[model samples]
Target: MRFFILILLFCCTFKGFSGDFSGTLNGAFTVHILLGTQEKAFNFGVSIFGTSTYKSTSVEGGININISPFFQKYGVYQGNFAGSMEFFGLIGYGKNANLLGSNVGLTRHTAFYDYTKTHNFFYGAGLVAVLNQATGNLKKFQNKQGGLILRFSDKQNSVAFNMVNDVNARPFSKSGTDKGNTARALISYTTIKNDELFGVGIGLDMFTPEADYGVAPHSHINSEEDTRLVLVNTKPYDDLFHLNLFSSFVYQNDDISFDGRFGVDNYKLGALVQNIIHDNFGLYPRFSWPVTQKGRFYSLLDFNVPFNTNFNE
Candidate 1:
């Protein structure tokens, strides 16, 4: 992991000093630390991030640590890649779900490469691996995934497709003999105008007797927060078929920007332990204004609601 980070830093430094380099370099660093006492127990949290970009290539690395008497968690991640004909890899480790009275530690590594000779066409492939270990045992619970992506776009319209296969196994428990193979496919289309964009997408997931789409690996890791979102869905559903449909739109101008999404799906919702599907909707809008040369003020609102009706049943 350190080697990969060093390579990325080296690339950025070399590019900045090269005589033939004509692109610009930009970077940012941020750090936050909080220490206090909650109910007579010590509590503390620390977060640090550093990012740098040269032309079309960028590098980002961050770490988050939270410690308290009742709970403790930490995570580290880094990514480096280019815009087109892209190549990047990410590795992360953190505490995940709890199983059988023991905390599960998750370590994940993801990588991908895309060939985008022209700005309108792209083809790519990606791979992901996740290792789960219990507190006091050396046993392994592993999930592996591979996927293919293709996209085509023009001035006003764009289309993209993705297909992935996932396999998971636990070799040290009573369910050691149980293994699962699942597959999923997603396709989306979008139309763009001067200041407006709209898109719709559908996804189909096929589950085996022991596998569920809710626990499948993501196509890529954009950030630590993205990975956390995926990890939150730990439930297993044996349903043979799962379908999802969604639409989204964005409208922005010099004054304000608005974006919202709505979706209906039969996939499992880990938060709602019920074994049913429903329609979900969300809306987010932001208003911003410049206060000073280097200062800006913004107000944002996010709303989400779920319907009780079983739309997919």
Candidate 2:
């Protein structure tokens, strides 16, 4: 992992200094001092980020290090190919247990590409691989994922579709084999008036947990007993689904410009009229006021209230 990161860093720096290079390098150091009722704490952090672009290709790399009770570090690198393809990688390591109560190390890599002829339509597919290890317990998880995206836009209308799936498993485990999978699909369409002042949009999102299998340690079971915890296979939308319809409008004059969006979902409709709000129905209005040449005040309002509770049959 260290070697890979160094290689990417070298490439980024070499490219930045190469012929006719356009790039930026940034660095920051931060110090934090906290005073509490019982104890005081002090910590510092440093980060270096850089980006380089040669014609249509670009490379970005960054690293962050924090010196606290426990040392923490993270690094990320991404490269774009001719404005149509992308490659990305990230690594993180920490000495202290994270929120999950385990010392974690993570590595991830992803690659994707988009193809378009007239610039009005696009299609792409991507692959992802990840490794997550709990250094405290020597437990590791490997995830393989893939996704597809399609988009089309014209003067008055735009449409988009996306699908993704993930499969996670325990590799080289002595206790027992465990695996789980999930998938999601989404589609959206929007159309605007000829004047481009008002627009309406609709979208649907579907997600499901495909399968799950748990592992049991040998210490928790007898030698003669099976070590598998549980197995489950579920259908799409058995977990959650959402259908949304919304409208947006923009009004502008010489002095000020105003724009906002309001939307409702099937779950929201069921909640207000039928009193059958599903766990998935939480939509909020978003509005913003920007400071214009003649105005000095700016404000914005956007919020959502999400709930997840099972209804009694």
Candidate 3:
């Protein structure tokens, strides 16, 4: 991860100052301090993010890279949006055993219309390709995922909805080529004054591996689903220095074995303070409890900085 991040930073620095785009580079290094029931430590190696945008439309393309040591993630994204339609893609590497395949690499491509006049409805569709870095072949391409985004607002209230789904495929026992299909839906409501917010969502993930697919001997995929509810109150103070009280509940169920079923419940209570002294900065403190496990708590502090502020203009 450190090597990859160094390479990415070198590339960004080169392009931002020397490239023909005549753009600016912006970035920040965050300090992470976490206090939890299981452990308490401070790690400044949390994240490094940088982005650069070119000024000329004739040679228009932008790049972004993010690296996180705590999560063992490195991703680079590049896109061109000179015309009415925008095209972008991302290639990422992660060390999460459960989330990644044996190769630990993933890719995604997206092409969507960029219309500024309309705001009530929008959508994006894309394809995901997963590769095994061990072999470095173009063999594992997953299903196509599509999503719908809706936003509605008036004088008194605002509402938003987002939906996403992926086609199902048979799971791979050894390589884990196709893990499963997924579907997610979310809706949230907020007052125009931004005093309170409420949200609800559900997600389904199903995995099924057939033994006849030349896969190694392994158990079939386990199907799981989760439902979540959230509420937040931000009526304490002014915009710059305000308190947000929030809570959430989640129910999860899964079928991994033929003998029986499994289920669990989770609960969380938290608070967030936004815009301490700069734009897009905040502090989040949370406490989480599980039905059958020990409860834990943590805090997260984040800061965001934009380098090329005139890209959209």
List lDDT for all candidates, in order: 0.27, 0.27, 0.23
Off by over 4 Å in 2: 1-11, 14-18, 24-50, 59-144, 148-163, 167-181, 184-207, 210-313
Predicted candidate 1 versus true structure: per-residue lDDT over 155-184, tens digit per residue: 345565655544334321342211222344
The C-alpha stretches of model 3 lying farther than 4 A from their native spots are 1-144, 168-181, 190-212, 215-313
Error of 1 at 61 (Å): 14
Between prediction 1 and prediction 2, which has the larger TM-score? 1
lDDT of 3 by residue, 254-313 (tens): 211010111111121111111121124331211111212322332222222222122223
lDDT of 2 at 295: 15
Q: 2 or 3, which is superior by lDDT? A: 2
lDDT of 2 by residue, 1-313 (tens): 3432552464356432666554444444444332322113333434344334444443333343433321211100111110001122222221100011000101110101112112222122222222222121111222233344444444334444544434333321332212122233445453333322222233222112223323222221111222222223233222222222334333322222233334433433212221112213431110011111121111111111111111111
Ranking by TM-score: 1, 3, 2
Q: Tell me how candidate 1 scores on lDDT.
A: 0.27
* TM-scores, one per candidate: 0.31, 0.27, 0.27
The ten-residue window of minimal lDDT in model 3 covers 96-105
lDDT of 3 at 220: 19
Which whole-number lDDT from 0 to 100 does residue 153 have in model 3? 36
RMSD of each: 20.2, 20.4, 20.3
